[model samples]
Target: MNRRQFLCTTGAFAGWSGGVACQARAEAYTVDRALVLVDLNGGNDGLNTVIPIGDPLYRALRPTLAVPHDQVLPLDERTGLHPSLGPLLGAWRGQELAIVQGVGHDAGNRSHFRSRQIWDTASDTHEYRDDTWLAHASLPAASFVASCTDAARSIAQHEAAVVRIALHGFDTHENQALRHAALLGQLAQGLMMLRARLIASDDWHRTLVMTNSDFGRSARENAVGGTDHGAAAAHFLMGGNVRGGLWGAAPRLNALDTGDGLPVSLDFRQLHATACAHLGVAPPSSVERFAPLPLLRV
Candidate 1:
């Protein structure tokens, strides 16, 4: 049979009815899950977006910048959304989004550069000397969209996806910010396309984005000005199966004194555990060691 026919026949098992050969090719792969991680680059503040407006201390500390308790989009009594993150509100409203608050590794470094590196490498301060961070496994099989020529190389050494694209620069749009966001959206779409290309299965799972900086960073720093790193930034799980709602405590700005930044409720180790589990790796710390957070359940 031709490739198209082969894909069509196989896609039937994944519940897809299509003449597209790619669909059949996709069906051939038994493992069809994906994980898309994005870095916020600079440390994104969690406190601003997932605000704990109920806490008077929160308002007290950021008297000038605090999101008005009334103005914030209330997810619950304590948690609220920054106005700019309206797009995420839908996910929250649907209960598919799980916002694990207080998720920073304990004793996090406040320095933007160092903290970001630690997060990207997923290494503890102690293990920093051992280079274990560089030993991260490559993105799970067929789980990457090569965005750069160096993408393959980076993944080869560090075991991560560094997606590349062919788009050229030098846009003259009067609305630079809008244009930039548009380009990024397009880039995400392209990456999604690449992801789809890598899949050869009918039962394709959803995609997710993980990063150190929270969504609130772009709004606060780029739009507002300087930033102070906070704990427990917002993460996104985009797929058909996401639970779609707020999960985790709102950022406790008042509790900043407890650490260099707001304390994390969802342990980063737990997130690692969820990632491993999503890759179909079973638990009890046999394959990998990480704390189990509720991220997977949602």
Candidate 2:
């Protein structure tokens, strides 16, 4: 499939039938809020992204890959953020950004394709889903928005309540520090630009932006100075209505699952339910097993 078709099938507009159908039905809707999802396609290294400085295990496990305590941007006494995420420090300080920790579903799958499919469909590891959870949930018309291209402009120009932007390149099997830093820089810069545009257009307060990934990297770096597939990464939710300030429990470095990955502390579905609640949509009964997380205002 072509890039646009691939995006429509897998990205934010996954559920909608077609653009023509969406535009035709657009007049029937009255949207008061909006949601922007940034999908980090490859598994992000959560341990490095959100450093656990207080945990000695972190330093020992990731000796070569660990970000030094002095270099990390302090979020609290125990935990800090990667140096590349310095751009978001203002958002954290202003309480507009929330860090949701230890997010993953049960039975973490390590393969990129399988794990991402599971995350996209919001299905249990043992169960297979033909349709994505986003498709099942009632959403506003889907508009194809690519992050690298004119994403901010699209959000400013269109009235679509749900906009998704898919970004890749987090795999990082080699030279992780350089590659991940560049990717994180792009993310931080893109979000900052989007925020500026929204504020300029008076849509900042009404828009919610969140980030998700396939899974997380292993707590321990591999022999190649990179990480393998793991589980339970950190996510971010930012908006004016969001009650931000570190929403979930930090992942314990010493308490790893059998796969030597962080244990799932907060189910990803809870975050989905929270997003549905924020958008005034009900999550499908098939996937409503978890309650909506109290991350945002009703």
Candidate 3:
């Protein structure tokens, strides 16, 4: 199927009905907070990003690819941040960052397109959805913006309640070290820049920043020194009001699934629900089964 046909068939058209309904209800609700979603398009190697320094199993599993204990910035005795994420240490030290471990759905699908669709629609592995959860909720005109590389620019130009930034190139199937480091560095630098701008404009307190991905990479490295698509990666939530600290326990490297992938400790929908609460709106009816996480202090 062509791209347009595929999108329409999968549920992209499902939003028109909800959008109309939401427009009618929008007059009754008001929210002052803003949410920024940073999507890492490729499956991120969570094991390398958030090093489990104290876990013996991690070092044993990927001796060559593991970030050495000394290289990581310790968040606690057990875990630490990757070296390339040094720019984010300030947020962590100020208690404005929360690391949520093992964020993914059950029965993970490794395909890039399918997994991303599931995340975008917040659907189960067996189900197909066309409309994104965001489209089901209405806001004021020009209150939401979605972009792949222009989120920062768009945020500066438009007064939106929600902004989505999608960053690609996390799929590191070969020579991962160099590619991953560059990507992480860019992410760190961009976030720091955005934070500084927001704080200077006195908008930081009202804004929330979070990161997600299609899935996590395998714990074990391949022959080429890169990880394959896996499941249950780590995610981050940061902002002035975030309840900074670790939200979920790190996955056990030794107790991997049959495919040598980390088991999910936190479902991603919880994060979405939290965003809905922050924006003063109810979550999409489809995700009522999942509760919002206590990640914000507001």
Candidate 4:
């Protein structure tokens, strides 16, 4: 359509309009990105994984549990990885990792169930609600995952990027690392499902950002027991769309400072922003509002 006729056809229809231009720009881009969010249930100690060896404060915080500087898998002078996260580090080396550190909401609640709900709901600290409560009123009943009602219930109210999976076994502590790893696997699978959906939809012009995290709500105990509430956990993102290659500005190992028993560097919302940007959705006004990330590959 010519410019004059286009302008006369209402701004909405005018392909030249500002809003239309942005949307078209995003749509026109051929990046079919999908995401898999692995919400790690326990705050996995960020200082250890994305170590802050440069900071002496970190060394003083957890002398016993601290990952020594030499043992860390170095990303740079500022950060490193936990020995346990070997597989992920491989992804990092291959430029398939984007470690957005210091992720947590403001006035954080240390409660496992509460903090987790906040992460799920994207709500604020003062806004208390029943974890058992579900937003069935907002979801399409057909979309519900009958097998994992509680898991699906938490996020179904929000706009999902075509697919969703409900996870339930993250709270188990008997096999801590095993359970977390299993959860990660499931998250990866979920993203694969979303990827299939995106491809099937033929919206091959998008991008995806798969992400998931755990709350450090473990009740601290012995070597083979429980873990308590702490801070600094890990979230993994894969797929071809991610900037990857270990992107984030946090300290290194042996430099950790568990001041409030959590990493003080990264704010969870910033990671949320990164995710929203990856998902191709506008960032929410506040962390409480569910923001659509722009991390999709189209």
Best by TM-score: 2
lDDT of 4 at 73: 71
The CA lDDT of each predicted structure is 0.45, 0.74, 0.74, 0.45
Which lDDT tens digits does candidate 1 get at residues 57-97?
A: 76555545666677787887867766655555544565555
| Clash number by candidate, in order | 26, 0, 4, 76
Q: RMSD for all candidates, in order, please.
A: 10.6, 5.8, 7.4, 10.5
Return the lDDT, model 4, position 127.
Answer: 77
Per-residue lDDT tens digits for candidate 2, residues 162-280, read: 66676678887777887887777777777777777777877777778888898998898888989888889899888767877887888888789877789999998888877777766
Better by TM-score, candidate 2 or 1: 2
TM-score per prediction, in order, is 0.59, 0.87, 0.84, 0.55
Error of 4 at 282 (Å): 3.6
* lDDT (Cα, tens digit) per residue for candidate 3, span 41-119: 7898888888888888888888788887788989889889889999999999999888999899999999999998988
What clash count does candidate 3 reach? Answer: 4
Candidate 2 local Cα displacement, residue 154, angstroms: 3.4
TM-score of 1: 0.59
- Expressed as tens digits, the lDDT of each residue in 98-199 for candidate 4 is 666555666566667677777665566787644311111111222213322322222222222322233455544344545544554444444444434434
| TM-score winner, 2 or 4 | 2
lDDT of 2: 0.74
